[model samples]
Target chain A: MKPIEARTERGRRAPPLPSPGVRFGEGFLDRLGRLALRVRSRRERREGGGEARLLGGGMEFVGFRPYRPGEDLRRLDWNLFARHRRPFVRVSRRESSERWSVLLDRSASMGTGFPGKLQLAAEVVLGLKAAANIEGAEVDLHLMVRGEPHRHRGRGAALAEWMELLESTEARGRGGLARLLAEPGRFKDARALFLVGDLADLQPADIPRLTRSGRDILLVQVLAPEERDPTRLPEATHGDAVRWADPESTGVRTVRLDAHALAEYERGLGARLEAWRAIAAHHRVSFTTVTSDTPFEAVVERVFAR
Target chain B: MSVPQVAAALALGIEWSRPSGLLLLGPAALLLLLARRSARPVERVTATFDLWEDAMRRIPPAPRTRRLPPLPVVFAAVAITCAALALAGPRIVGSDPPRVFTILCDRSPSTSLPLQPGRTRFEVALEACLSELARRAGSTDRVRWRSQDRETLELPVGVKPPASWFARPAAFLPEIEWEREDRPGFLWVTDRVPTPSPSHALVFASGGRGVPGPVASRGGERVVWREGGLRVEPAPGRVVELRGVEAGRLGPLARLLTIWARERGFELRGGQERERALLIEAGRGAGETRELRIAGGSLGWGLAGTGGAGGIAELPEGAQVWRFGEASGGEAPILVAGSPGRVLLAFDGVRSVEGDPALFALAWSRFLDRWVLPAPGVVPLDERRDAGAASWDEWSEDRFEEVPRVGAGRGETTSADLLAPALAGIGVLFATLAILLSGGGISWLRGRLPASRTRT
Candidate 1:
């Protein structure tokens, strides 16, 4: 198999690319507690999933409400009705199977840079698993690899094993995001969909098709620092020349690593970003660049905050 | 024999030497505004070879928000900067006597060799010097040099006499009279390296007539009439052997020859081995009385009319008579001819010349000195070469620094206008920048300038 990254090259102050088990800071799991999830999707994912409460009949009491003329008489509280001589209804929160389908791209391009995006993808998946455990939501992880998708489907109890599965997942495939999302039943009826990838080959026209109507779609653009701006790393000594080999294909680019080229690259990148933004906006899909260098918990927060 | 010389140089700041330079910034700003540079577009000019030049020039300037091309910006910036500096005078504060350079005209024997047809080595070097130095002031930059005839010309460079002022037909000697005064430094402008290496002070050069070129051209004998007496000398480095004449009778003739030989570094070869030896046999005066005469190449070196002569010795056929003197019996041959194909001379024993032996000996030796020696610059005698001759290789190189120059400290610090030199340098740089930014350099590179609807 080809190497996942160019080399173990990084700036002096930058942290080493996280390995399969790079230790996180103390209270990393506790920090996960700070995250809150609010799903706007009213669709039911499955029979036992924590779906939105369109009609509630579970035993857990959540609140009381004034009775409406069309309200079912079974839900009215007799005690409250006698005291105030007013009709009152008992409201309880519903417990349903609300599944979150996260399509984490494992394309070869994501694996090809300093502090490779593959590492960030692993961290993002671990984060979603933890957040799902807290919200009592089921996670259906679709690792977008070549051939068959590597599926890790579960709720709270299986989350630890799911984290291990994500950590072990390598960026060893090339799945053009547009092609994968076009497949029928891509997410298996999940309430919300989170798409994570560097999106090297993704087209703006594919945004609407990838985002389901009435579904919460958060598309996270995982970029290594060098990818966002080639001039940021220590290796970017301008006026020097570098020959780049494309990881997704056999194509290569010979560039003068100078200020002018860097500027032009940045301009093109901005245009690419705007393209993603405009299309994502039209589709009601939230899109953002999630860099690898950021703290994992903060990265997780950014992913959900959208 | 030699002295060490002057020194080596290599700054910046806000001290405005020419404050008026600030006015330049306005004009510079205006020019930049009118002809502002723009970033080069990163597109290939698809126009064919013919239209490529036009297309290149027609590349529209970058947007105002973008950066300008560094080359034109740098040049324009520097040009404006220099124009400012030029307007603002800058001066360094310093003071000291300007240097005194003594150009040692190499009168060394080797200089006599003809480097080009009709021009000796010394003559060529002298003519080369006709183009004056950088033309500094006489007071500030002094020059001291001696003509080939030994007349010293000392004056500042600008005020010094022109090339014509150097006396023509200068003579060469085996050695030059070095200055004994202990000046701190001086520059040695000689083809021959008189010194060993850069480590020590240079010294007198070796005696070898290095690289025996074409057989030496005869630099005729020189004789001058002085106030008190007549001074006579031969073409330098001539060797002659005397026979049958006693030194006691000849007065100082013997001593003079010894001195000339030592001075010119001439090798005194044995008479039998000599190729151009003069044979002079004393002849008996015994014939009828006859009037005498003197003539030929002998008159070329101060010899004049002869007195009436009588019975002397007769010369054989093919023997050329040099001079005739009055004798009791017949005319005596003062200087007679030598063997076939040779110009040797010997006085046949009847030696009283001008009725005074001493005067005749003196004049004759000086006269014979020319013919006696092989040509003046013939193959230089091998014996004169010493270990010091190795330095000849040093001269083959252009490393003149190895030979010491006149040593003089830069004078005491005074307020020398530093602004002047800075402005001068900036002016040069600005010229270069102008050429570059104005597309003159590009025209040269492209082989042809982009036509502005311009005809070839």
Candidate 2:
């Protein structure tokens, strides 16, 4: 694989790399390895690319087949022809690998969680990048923020560079998952698309745009535990009254915390999740909910296993 | 109202003292308005609000709160109410230190009438008078008990009267020239109305089957006739001749007789008196006979109609009996007369009279004035002539109403300072509760409460 090339823009520069000897935690790497093995096994089973197989002989002379009209002359086995006095062709099996596109949402809402949804999403992206590296597959990293994509490519040290970029990244503005998916130029030959976002502000119709590309689409919904069950949130449970402000719009509302209000909130959340699920199903997308508190490796294993 | 005036009004039992304090309500309302205009600090949150916003839209907006929270406003209201009340000086008036009371009790013969089975008119009058004194007397108030006939006697606080006090007969005549400045209040308890005076007087009329006839007066004196007796004005003086009677036999009655004579300007002669003088003679013996001429008729004592001592006796024809003795079947007459100028008095218990000398003196005094002496210059006033027939309104006015002159004395006004502490306490309690409710105490308490099941 080619080393990832740095792309620079007029007013934006790539994030600086971390110093040498800096590495992800060993425990995180071990979990990532386990998750990578599972993904590779699954991929191999589905695509039949786990081992080498012989076809028509090549320079290694693994096997031969009788020559047919209009066959390539370069692939003809001359030794077999001279010995057997018959035309033959050589063949060889080629190793196949998948390309994965990891899309991370860096919206303002993602920055709201305790461990931060953006941090969790970055961890998940790192896990996927590590898996692809082990599998000798091509990987692309995209940070979707404010309807613009910041892209990086490669593995190993490139993975470290991506990690450093994500570490220095601050979540702000709006995510453009739907916009990025609609732009074919952004992910033109990618085999699989892994999106990590809260998807909180996205419309239900926005998710189906990913299906237009006919690529393997995985929708990983990264959410804070408080977002998943707001009634358990301190603000909602500890006081008789609370004021909720929107991070994106800066709009505000005050509400009384009561059993009825909590019930309504839970119902609304359930409905939202259900609507997302339905949208995902209609678009043939794999959808999963991951909380910021969930281990990144566990998220990767669950989301990429099947 | 002026502060002192408001305080005074409060002291006098007026409601809503310091009405001007209501102006504070306007400021309180303004404070509330400013609070409402002030915005609550916003809470910065990051979760997607689309669903919550939608849900909120589905429901109605919560009722707008005061710029201040409910708890704080409630507390403020409580504090204001308390402060207003305190400034207003809300109080219950009239619980002042006791006042001095001088009570004059009537112990006339008519007061002995049994108005109820067990209670005499005098007993009823005494109770009513003492209750009045008690009502006016504070812990430190001094009370003096005076009989119409006797000198005033200071009574210890809360002391109960002996039953004999009510039974004792009139010991002295009412003092018409007494001054009012000697005591804060002067109460007269009697069966007949006395002359109204410039001095503040509380007259409690007791006894008799019906209300006494309106009082009638001539000159400075007044009189009323009721209770089966002639209640005269200015009891007249009389000269009495004691014939054939030894002073030693009269016991304590001798001294009382002399005092009565001195009070009435009467002389007690040692021998038979001249014409128109009262004659007192003990029966010479069980057999001694005495002739009495009255009202153009003549009767012989110890004769057929006038039996011996302790026997039923009848007055001669045309003779009027003024008063009766206690003996059953009318054995003796307390006072008898032939005409307005002629009268005779006799009694069998001179030895026993010493036991209650004042009572006996009063009885003899009344007998002398009614039977022997000419009526005093002050004539009896008839109720029908002076005040007309009694009406219920007038009766109630006469019995129950008291018109006090403004600023007369502390006796008419009450102090209300006792209510200050209580009103202040109530205000403070409300303020404390408001503080707790408004100052995050509610949330703290909610935290302490069992978690609601619906809260995830």
Candidate 3:
């Protein structure tokens, strides 16, 4: 019992990984991308075959298009006939030519890898795009990719175009998760605002505000596996002194991780997790953190489960 | 001691013994009890609160009320009281001196000077003291002595006199002056003047080595005067012999003698030259036939007798002796017999021509009767008397008076005997002063201090 507490204690003070992707190197990132692609394909196959009318799931309607055979006959544009008198079918989906925003956190913390948190984050966005494509949801990309990525939006096939664009972008340094959520353009169509980074950056008070204006928020926290179970194995007994950078500034403070300190960290970490769970539960928002070494498929499963 | 002072002390002691006064002891005990009670609370409170530093500040707390130091003032008042009482002459009653002799010899530094070639003032004074002792040889005696340069006493008047009397000048100097002022007509032994007397015999001595001055007298009668710085000399001459003087004429000498005798322990009777005739009539009461004969002289007297009832008499000069019967010629002895009787004999200062053996025989014969008079199995004096005669004087004419009182007619020097009472009074005074100075002073000082003052 004593050793168990000692191990837990040691894991607690283990400093945060340098970046979520640092735990996973290139090979880990490739594996995560492969897993993400598999989850995306499987989700598409299931949802497209079984749930055909997912376009109605969103809050707003996209514009009407020329009617195609086998399109739902009930989605025909009776209103447009009364206005322009054309035999057009209503798109009856959020898929439109409106701009969409993709805010990627390039903070130094995103580099920590086990299952490659940064790679997984990118894959999450790519998967979201793939899922949206089957439901005919348009996508616009506001990429805060490395420094600050620009926003662009367009229609049906262009949604896949945004996913390809996100995959090619690299994660960089220092920006607020709230700054991305607070942007008016991100909520222009009352679109889903998916934050792909450690939700550690967003304070508790910020959650209510993000939801107050009626924007859909999906928080994905990218954490390393060691962060989840920070226990020390016998081989790592001397102690791990980890130096973490501010990600927003040139400053760095060295944190010493040992059995005693680890215990304190675990206590704090447990408290923080509880606090986040409470906030998310109150706001009826979906929140899930993907740890290092977690299969990307598990993340996909968690996102839908939320 | 004043009886009231003793009673007051006894009353205070009795007050302390009672229950009410015993309750006065409660405060100190209660203080201890309260301290004990508060101790646990203080400790618990101190433990419960994390502020140990604040608790320490509160303990043995700061004075609740300001107070000036009263100890010094109280001590001063006490000292004043003691000084006043001392000045008031506090004293206790003391015992009369036991029958003992104190031959105070002055041996100051002044005693070193000589009046003649070989004799210093010290030697002459010592000789005079020796003569005085010889006059009183057989009585229990103690010698007290001092010198300007040395001191000696076989057994001190109290427990002990100073062993190092020469270490200080105080001891012998006062005695010399005291002797000179009090006891005149003897040698005033000292180095310096206070002048010499013509008729008063004197020997003076001085300290430090030197050739003595010549001894001389301006009067026709010559004597050695001084040697070194000290004067050692006889008086010019005896002015006149005191013999043949009338009863009134020898007043001073008799008084001086009586005092000396009282100090030395001889139950003296009569006045100075005031003849007392105790006429013990022979054959006054009928009982066993007993005879007593007293004989001898002014210088030495012998008492002898043949018969069971016997007595001895001492007669000095111009004193008359009468015989009811014929004088038995063998030693000019007066013989008496009868039941219970006494005789009075008196003599002038005339020597007896009787030889030593006859005198010794007479003395021995008296001792023989005196020895048998009070044998253990014989009827004791009290038992011999009848029941009606409860008092001793009713039964016997020769009952002992425990203390002899003197009348004014005799002018003997009772002054010397006053020394014991004087010394005792001084001791009492000093002891009372010492107690008041030390004990009372301390108590009063303690009382004056403020009760709130805490000594940490």
Candidate 4:
């Protein structure tokens, strides 16, 4: 076969090149946007820790006041009694040395794929540890997994270590909140405690016990979309029989999930959420529900912004 | 005339015989005698004038064409001829009458009448049929008996030794072993003659149930009821009852019963044991079209509450939405784009969710669609015959008739008797019209003044 030579017509012209000015690029705003996040993180550190001021003072005796009825007797200031007629507890510039404890639920229900409840809980714990560590308060992180509770001291780089552990964790079994309550010394010396879980298998006692020590307790409930509504199921080729196995008890129940039953399920799940809300309210512990469908960044922004 | 004589005369094609024609001619002669006695003539005068000088003045008259009145005698003669012809009752075609003797006996349990002097209903019917052949049959004629199983069999015409016979519980089927050089006339014998066609004369003997088939034509050309030994029922009754006779033939009877049941659109299958589960991929809206593919059942497309097009069993447990159309892919749950009239969901083993207030709220969400059933609780039939909603006119042209028999082959007459009567009737009407028209013309001619009269 002979090769054919290609030639352009005399009157034809080449297409003009694209203008450089009109070209799209990662612009200055994009670079500055990165710098802006760094500034925000630095500002967050400055305003975030309530303990920084308390830890900044170098041994100045500030003042004293009479200890309240619920105050720990170990905190009665003997030096303040010499100056005042009544026995008093020391009130110093180094605001009371409060210990921080973070309790996380590691139940199987929290292991949903996106905006994971476990991951959200870990992030909240990290924030609390950063606040406590900068303020000279001791921090402890505890995981309410199916087995025994795992505790880690919130020290230098411990938050990252804890995050790495959480990242590597796999969801298995159930009975999270119950197991956490059963373990002794898990919430030791905690001035304030944060409990994070979907509270699927949680009992009424689980909430009250954490706040019973008079510490300011916050219960952050994390749930997946299925946990919240559970009526939404994907299309399937199989038949009507679906087996729901209880992660902890290994109990299985087969049910027909038609449209009517799905509606009923949603209604009941709503009632359960409301009941949880009411229980937390009565105990005076702050309660909030976090959905797994929300991005983790949005959740962090909302919680930290408040 | 005696019955056989009358049958023979019919076979000979003498419909009116000689006596009937004479009877018609007698009336014609009486009418002729009356017309001759009533005739009378009245005279009229006419004046003639002579043309001469004064005495002969001419009277000029206008020429008038005188028409002659029709002669009634001619009409009388024609009427007489026609009356004789009508009395003669001529058959236009020649056909040899059938010599076949078809005895149809009812072997049903209802036919087990103890009044007959035989061992069984089949035996009684057979004996009666055989005896009829012995009494009235010609030397070359044969005897056909309605077997207990409702089929026909022929017997030897002459005095012969008893042949070996076998009996099934339902009926008897006789097979002849020896072939004689002279074959007797053909015989169609059956118990409860399934039907009486134009071809066979049905001698229905059993008083129990009538024949189980369509009414057969009865005429000299088609059929003649065998008169003396066995009685024949004219028509097959509406309902047919079949009862299994006794212990010996129940197995074969059961098979026959099964065949009948299948004919009535009942199907029997082995029991199914496995339980099935459903996997439904529903879209966002309840009203959105869904494609449901059932594991064991049909794959169909439909709305939630409405019944679907396929053979899918009702939606399975744990299915939030029933799918229809084709299966879909890509992460977002199949978004039912439209709102349906109604939606139903089944929770997979999550009993606690039944009472969940949240699930109900989500189900009623405006974003979701609802599906309405055109008719609720109506289960459609799988087969076309059982589909009660279908109109008769909608039935398939194919297979509408149960047993399609081969019609008359080329050059053969399917029904000469039927066509012959219709053609003869048409010819008679035309002849009547011609006679009336000719009679009218003759009457007009008779009313006119005749130029000359020739007849006496």
Q: Predicted chain A of model 3: TM-score relative to the true chain A?
A: 0.64
TM-score of each: 0.37, 0.38, 0.30, 0.29
Off by over 4 Å in 1: A1-30, A36-100, A105-124, A135-138, A146-148, A152-176, A183-193, A196-306, B1-67, B70-72, B76-276, B279-456
Please provide, for model 1 over A8-101, each residue's C-alpha lDDT reduced to its tens digit, 9 standing for 90 to 100.
Answer: 1223222122222323345654654454332222111212232222223443566567776644567788999999999777665434476777
lDDT tens digits, residues A1-306, model 3? 011111012223323433334222346445545655665565445433422223333334445555545444566778876788775654444444323344556455565554456667766665565555543456555546445545655455553455456555543555546556656555566455666776646677787766633345667777656555445322125453333333333333223335544565566566667787788878766678767456556775676545
Weakest lDDT window of 10 consecutive positions for candidate 3 chain B: B41-50
lDDT of 4 by residue, B1-456 (tens): 345544554576443323355466776566656655433111100000000001111112223222222345445544665656554544322322222443444333323323244443345445655665555444544445543333345654554323332233221123321122112222222223322222213232322322122112221111222322233344311111222122122233224323432442222122321210111122222332333322211221122221122323343322234333334454323322221222222211111112233433334332221222111111111100111111111112121111121242323443322333443455455445545567675565665636434441
Better of 1 and 3 by DockQ: 1
Model 2: runs farther than 4 Å from truth?
A1-97, A144-147, A155-157, A212-214, A234-239, A257-268, B1-46, B60-62, B65-456
Please provide, for model 1 over B1-456, each residue's C-alpha lDDT reduced to its tens digit, 9 standing for 90 to 100.
001111111134233434665787787676665544333222111101111122223333232233354556556666776767666654322223354555556655455544556765556554434333333222455677753445567776656556664433222234543443213323333445543333322222222233333333233344333343334445543333454444333334345444544444443333533333333332222343233333223333222321223323455433445544333455445544432223332322222233344554455555445334344234333212222231211221122212222343344333233445665587678768667666767676465656633655
Q: Residue-wise lDDT of candidate 2 within B1-456, one digit each (tens)? A: 346646665566644446676576676677666665444533435465665665565555555543454657756776777667676655444433334566667665455445567875656666776676555444555566776544466666567556555444322233344344222366766554554532456666563453343244332234666664546465333465665466555545456556665665567667754422445554322332332211211221121112124321434333446443333464444333332333333432244332243444556567555544322322223312222121111112222223232244543544444455556788788777876776476766666667743462
Model 4 stretches astray by more than 4 angstroms: A1-96, A113-115, A134-136, A144-146, A235-243, A253-258, A300-306, B1-456
lDDT of 4 by residue, A114-217 (tens): 45566566655555555555445677777744477888766554644765666666555554766776774767667667777667667555676566543656
DockQ of the two-chain complex in candidate 4:
0.00
The weakest ten consecutive residues by lDDT in model 1 chain A span A1-10
Tens-place lDDT per residue, model 2, A1-306, is 111111112333222211111134557656766777776676555333221111212223335567766454666779999999998776443223355787777766777666777778888888877766755557888776445776776534476577677777777665546545556577766667888888775667876655544366788998777667776665565444555555555465565555656666778888888988898777667788978889887888777553
- Please count the clashing residue pairs in each candidate, in the order shown: 56, 11, 62, 85
